[model samples]
Structure formats: C-alpha cells, structure tokens
Target: MDAKSIKEEKAELEIWQYIFGFTPVAVVKCAIELEIADTIESHGGAVSLPDLASAVCCSPSALGRIMRYLTHRGFFELHESTHKYSNTPLSLRLLLKNGANSVAPFLLMEASPEMLAPWHRLRASAAPGGGSAFRAVYGEDFWDYASQNPAVSKLFDDGIASHATRAICEIIERCGDVFEGIGCLLDVGGGDGTTLRYITEACPWVRGINFDLPHVVCVAPQIRGVEHVAGDMFKHIPEADAVFIKWVLHDRSDDECMHVLKKCREAVPKETGKVIIVETVIVEGEEDEYSDTKLALDMVMMAHTEKGKERTFEEWDCVIKGAGFSSYTVKHIGSIFSIIVACP
Candidate 1:
C-alpha cells in the first residue's frame, strides 16, 4: 500500500470541487433574488450585515453567511475589520439598473424554478425518443408556454435584453461598420426590440423593423425610428435592405434554420442584400474561456430547445449554403458571437 503523494491528493480533491460546482449556482440565485448587489449599490456601495439583512428582509446571521460565501466567490469584497460588504466589479455588473451592463435579469431568469425544472429532467431527456428536457417538463413548445404565461414571457423578454445588451454594445463599439450602408434593417425575433433599439440609437439614419410573433411585438415598447411588426419568419419576412437575427437561429434545427434563411434571402435584394446572423461559431479544437461558454450554452440549448444545439463553423457553412446564399463571410467580432453575413 503506497501512500498518496501531495500532488495526487490534490488531484483527488478535484473531483470534490467538480461535485461542488452546482452549490454556488443556488447560492448566487438566492442572492440575486434578494437583490443583494442592488441593495449594496443603493447603500452607497457598501453595507453592514445587519443593514443588508434589514434592507432585504433576511435575518442578519443568515444574510451574513450568504455574504460570506459571495465575498469568497469574488462577488463582493469584505472588509474584515469593519465587517462591511461592498460590491466587487463582478457584483456591480449584477445590479438591476443604473449599471452599464446589468446581467441580473438574465441570471434571475435562468435561476427561476421553471427554468431549473428542465435541468432536473436532463437524464430522461437524453433517452431515446424522450424529447427535450423543457418539453418533458412543460409538455409544450417554449414559445407557446411563454405566450400562455405572461409573467414567464416578461421574464424571458427581460432576460433577452439583459443577455444581449453587453454583446450588442461590444459589437457596436468594435464593428459599427456593419450598420453602415443599410437603409432598412429588420430584426427577426427582435424580442421587444432590444437589439434594434441599440442599433438604431447608434445609426439613427437606419430605419428599423422589429419583427416577431404578434404576442411578442404587442408587448414591445415603441422606440424612435423603429417599427414593431408582427409576423412569422418561417412563412414570410418583411422586405428590408438587410435582415438581422441575433441569438435566434440556434433555437431551431438545420431545416428550420434553412427555411428562415431562405425567407430572409427572399426579403432582401438579389444584388446586394445580406442576412446578418449573430450566433456562436463552435470552433473545433479550441480550448479557452469563450469555447467553454459556448459549450455550456450548447447544453442549455439541449435542455431548452427541441432540436437546437450550438454548431461548429462547418455546420454553419452547411446551413448557409443550403439556404441558397451565394457566399458568406465570417467576421469574428470582438465578442463571443460571430457575425456571418450571407449574401443573396
């Protein structure tokens, strides 16, 4: 019987770390639901445990424990001597509002009970002919469920806005040229026009049509220089100089994606029209933070969508060519999403 070396013992502990990976998710979800970061921000950037507990209606000891874990997780900074907690850069980004890029709504949506339910069925969802985890739980399409549940719909829309805002801002900052030379831009599955509002704000000259289902567009607020139009992309897309779809295509299978792409192709001009697709391009053999995120998102797709998963560049190439596009150029924008411009 040989004794384990120090390195071997540390390697053995890695499995325990992996086992504990899901613990923070629940803790963070609880903190997010209580608006812990927002409370700290509202308190002029720091607060004592008792004050935070009072603000959020939690017991001092319980809130202190939560804050202890959060501070260790790099979410908050703890001043040990004074016993005050302050927002770290990571926590500031979780603020509900008055923050540059708030990710609170998106995180909250994923943390909600309904969203978590699908994850519970992940194993059964993998069985032959069992269908998606979400369908197994809800017994309906995601869009249909959202349309039926107003509260869920609102959360979803807010999540989309929160999730897309940072990526859109980065794209506009680095790849603003994509908006130029466009007279009319139609945002497919525009999701309350969050993406359009960002784009039109940057390029005021470009008129925009925010297109989605009637239920979705009905809830969308009116934005200057952007019209909310309701329609089905599978059947017809409103004619535009260019069609823009961000984080939309990955929800459908290849055939459905091809159908929408063809519709987009038909909506634009033959000579110079293009469809701007903003999605994850799964680069093969890439092992990095971005790839890790993309892969995790692929699992999310499996749980949430019926037949959707993140795709490699090769998969994207097949869909683009199947849509009858003459050619497409891939631009690695300074964001996780790649911009694929498919020409008619």
Candidate 2:
C-alpha cells in the first residue's frame, strides 16, 4: 500500500476502536464468569496455560486466546518463554478471593445482556417525550424490574455495594471530619446499609439510620448502631443531626431533587445540622483522571433513567438553593465523586 493510504487506514482503525470497544468489556465479563484472575492468583499469581485452563474447566486453546487478548489489554502479563500467565495490577482487582477492592460484580452487571440491550435504544430514548432505554427494552423501569426479579435485585445490590466499598472507605478516611459533632446520622436511600455500616463502625459515637424503600430495608442485614428505616425520601425523612445522601440525586430530575432536598432540609436542625451528598459533579473545561469515567457515567445515567443526568457546580447550586439550603461546600473525593456539604 502507498504511504498515504497506510496512514489513512491506521487513522480509520483508531476511529473503529470506538465502534467495537464492547469487545474488551465482553471479554472481561467472560474472565469474571470463569474466575480466571482468581484461578491464576490461587496458583501464586502465575500459572501455565494448560493448568489455568484445567482449573477453569475450559479448553486450553480457547483460554489461551482469551488470555492473549487480556494480556494485550494490560489486564494480565504473559511470560513468553514459559507460556505462562500472571495477574497484573488490573487483574488482581478482579480476583474473587482475598483480593482487595474486587470490582468483579460491577463488571459482571455492566457487561450483562440486560444492561447492554438498552444501549441500542439510546437514540430513541433521547427523543423528546421518550423515556429510558432500559424501560424501552424491558417494558419497566430499572428499579421496578429489580424489585420483581430477586436474582437481578441481588446482583444490583451486590454490584453497587461492591463498587462503593472502596469509595466509601476513602470518603471516611479523607472526609471523616464531616461526621464530627453528629449524634444521629440518617443515610437517605442507603441501600443495604453498607455506607452507614462503614460510618458507624468508624465513628462509634454516632448512631446511623439506614433509610430506603421498604423492600430494600427488608433485605438489609441488621447492623449494630445502625437502624434500618423504610420510607420515601420525597415525602419525609426522619430527623437527624446530619442527613447523608450518596449517589441518589443524579438518578432524579431537578424537580425531584428539589423535593428530596427540601425534605432533607426539614430533617435537620437549622442551627447545626447539614446534608452530605456524594455524587459526581461535572465541571466544564476541567480535565482530570476521572473525567472519562464521569462523562461515561453521565451517558449511562441518560440511558437508564427518565430524567436523571449529571450536573455542574452551577446546576447543583440551583438545586441546593431551590431546596432552601443557605450554604454549601464541596470536597472532591478520590477521582470519581465529590462530597457536597449543604446547610440550611
């Protein structure tokens, strides 16, 4: 091929990467299902292709192809001379056993057919008066479907909890000061009480209320010093010294957030109480390590919810003001989320 033709062809392939990017996601899901990372880690972080394949009960040739692609994608490392595989830092995070911060469940859920099917209908959902692609494909809202399907509900819960574990830990370490002087804390829409469990454990003096829908509270395991309560956030929230809402508002419209924030304002004392919100705040013209994930999640929110979308600082200010909060402050936590403390 001519030099110019070759250069153009390479550029086109780069563009094609965006079109076929789901390939890596699907492959990662396969690795999770087969516990490939766990298998390799079990063998002291390295294993021959034949042995690894045997442990996973798959054909060596097929598994070899999978490993080749994973290694090419930096998820694993290959020892060329020995024809063996080992876990990279990325792969270690997917290990099911004894691996710190495993996101296997999250990967599994995102790569599931149930989740991917909705993406095909994104254009339709984006049209005016059109609803979520999830609803378009499933004939019901994502939360409603989860309510009816026990398995999906469990997966959803587990996936979210798994993903939140590390983030919640970081928040406590980096922003634990937010809990000081709080006698009672209410976790609005705290699914399964995971976040509160961490908080109450870290701050033993603080009592926590895990508030969510009745069905969600019914399945939450009881934790000492954390009380589980069932109610809608739109209508009422139990009184507390501090009310915490994490990853909830982005799944709602401005009108809905205003309603919930108003309830939050009512739940806390005007003198000292505050509302703590943990979510992604998109800032225009600002680039960081989390920019890509934040933007990608914004799209995911659009595909899965009727009106939910990420907000900027100005948008957040508008909602906080609309809810009658007098002042607020934001602290960026890690790379993906921010902690906004709002006071009445």
Candidate 3:
C-alpha cells in the first residue's frame, strides 16, 4: 500500500514479461511462413509496409501490426521516417533462400500445430508414467503420428535435414580427423542419408552405411559411396569400424540407449572400433542464453517423446560406461551440441 512497496511490486511483476513469451515464437513462425525476410531481401533489403504486404499477399494494416511487433522484438529494423522495413541479424537467418543455414524449416516445424499441441498437455505428461504430452494430445506417439501423416512427416524430415546439413558439414570440415583410417562408417538411424553423403564426400576413403527403419531407408536418396540398409538399431546395426549416431540416442530412454549401444558394441571389433554420438549435453552453472536455450530444448524433448531428454556430462558418462565401453572422450562441437567417442 506504501509508495515504495507498490514500486517494488511493479518491478517484480516485470518478470512476468518473459514467463508468457510465446508471442515472439508465434511472430517469427508467421514471418517465416510468409517469407517476409526473403521478400525484403529480394527487394534490395528494405520495403515500405504496403509494398511488403503486397509481396506477401496480406493486408497492409495487418502486416503493419505484425511488423511492428517483430521490429520491437529486434527481428526487423524499421526506418522511422520512411516506414520501410529491413531484416535484422535475427531475421536474416529466417530467409528461406539462405539454404542449409537457414532455420526457417526448423522454426516452422516446431511452430506447427502437431508440435505445439503437446505443450498444452505438459502437466499430464510430466506426471509419473504419463509418457509423452504429444501422445496425451494426439492419442499416439510423435513418430507414429508423423508416419501416418505424409505432410507432417516431410516437414519433420526437411527440418532435421536442414539442420543436419549445416551441422554435419561443420563436423566434416573441422573434425574430419575423426574419420581417419576408418575403413567403414555406419550411420545408425541415418534418415535420408544426408549426413552420410556429406561424410563420404568429404572423406573419400571412408565407406558409409546408411542404416534406418525400413520405411525411412526405402526412400533415401541415392548416394554413390553410401549403402542404404534397413533395420532396427535396438536389434542390430551393421558392422563398421566407426558407428555414428547423431540426434538419435536422445530420443531414447537410458535403457533403450543402453540396448542400442550394446548392439553397436557387437557390430564393431572390440579392439579397433569406436562409436561416435552427437547430442546436446546440458551445460550447468550460469543461466546464460546458450544454457537457457538448451534447457528449453530439454522441455521440448520431455513433451514430444516417450522418454527422451537432454543429458548432462555425468549422465552421458553413466550410460556410456554402462554399455560396457572401456574408454570415452567428450568433444564440445560448439555451444549447441557435443561429440562423444566411446571405445569398447
């Protein structure tokens, strides 16, 4: 009731601004769908509201409101006097024509109804034995739902491939030494063989086996040095000098990952083989932007999959050691993910 107390209360309430922050995501998703970034770029980097709206086929007034919010969020830069808009550094990444590095597909996929619906049931899913919130919302699991819906399936695949193209290219360029002397490399759960193709092309001496579910492998693109093999990873993985599993194990529970790693152990020679895992290893300590993003992804995994989650270094070590690996090394690729090489 006092003036100082009222001021303190108002300051505390400011924290709520970030608590209900879905608006930025929704706005970015809409801009991506409308190709607003690309439109501005195509028009030589700036356009008035009316011109931009005409290009995006929307009402000038409606688009203006959206652009104002986006500009406030730093995604777009608005010229005060001219009312022309240009892409900011943040919005530049949403340009669809940017190709592999463009996150448009990934953002669009995450913002899709099929993906967003799960968050509504997060309370139930977080309960003991409740399983995925996605399942809670859709009656079936995420994978099964995607399998049945062709459009959703393509969106999922394209989104993953877009990210993988950039990440795998970086791995090949910066860490190509990881593949040296490897006679053969098996990419377990390699969807579409995009990563394998990149690896084989980068290291011509290394043969590649693209292994995945039957349905996934059936439509895999033809890559000359990579062989498409269809099978379940939990049951069996093709023999290889080095086994590469990227963005796969995180979709499994500890027990499930242990089973798949056991299969990987069996597939390679005990003395000479190594298994490479690419995944997000949660960094603890300060609440910086990178860690915050990683934490958000952890929630996404929790909501979308049966038992998947982002793990910390200690948690990853426990699973690797439990799978009977004699030694392992962790290499942080960048802020987003890490590479774990485990040897039997």
TM-scores for every candidate against the unseen true structure: 0.94, 0.94, 0.90
The Cα local distance difference test for each model comes to: 0.88, 0.88, 0.86
Q: What count of clashes does model 3 give?
A: 0
Model 1 TM-score, 2 decimals: 0.94
Q: How would you encode candidate 1's per-residue C-alpha lDDT over 1-344 as one tens digit per residue?
A: 34668778888898898989888878887887788888888899889888999999999888888888888889999887988888888887874544558888888788788888998888755888658899889999788999999899998999888888987888898788888999999999998998888999999889999999998999899999999999999889999999999999999999999999999999999997889999999899877668878899999988888888899999999999999999999988854788998999
Q: Compare candidates 1 and 3 on TM-score and give the better one.
A: 1
Candidate no. 2 TM-score: 0.94
Q: List model 3 lDDT by residue over 199-248, tens digit each.
A: 98889999999998787778778999999999988777889998999999
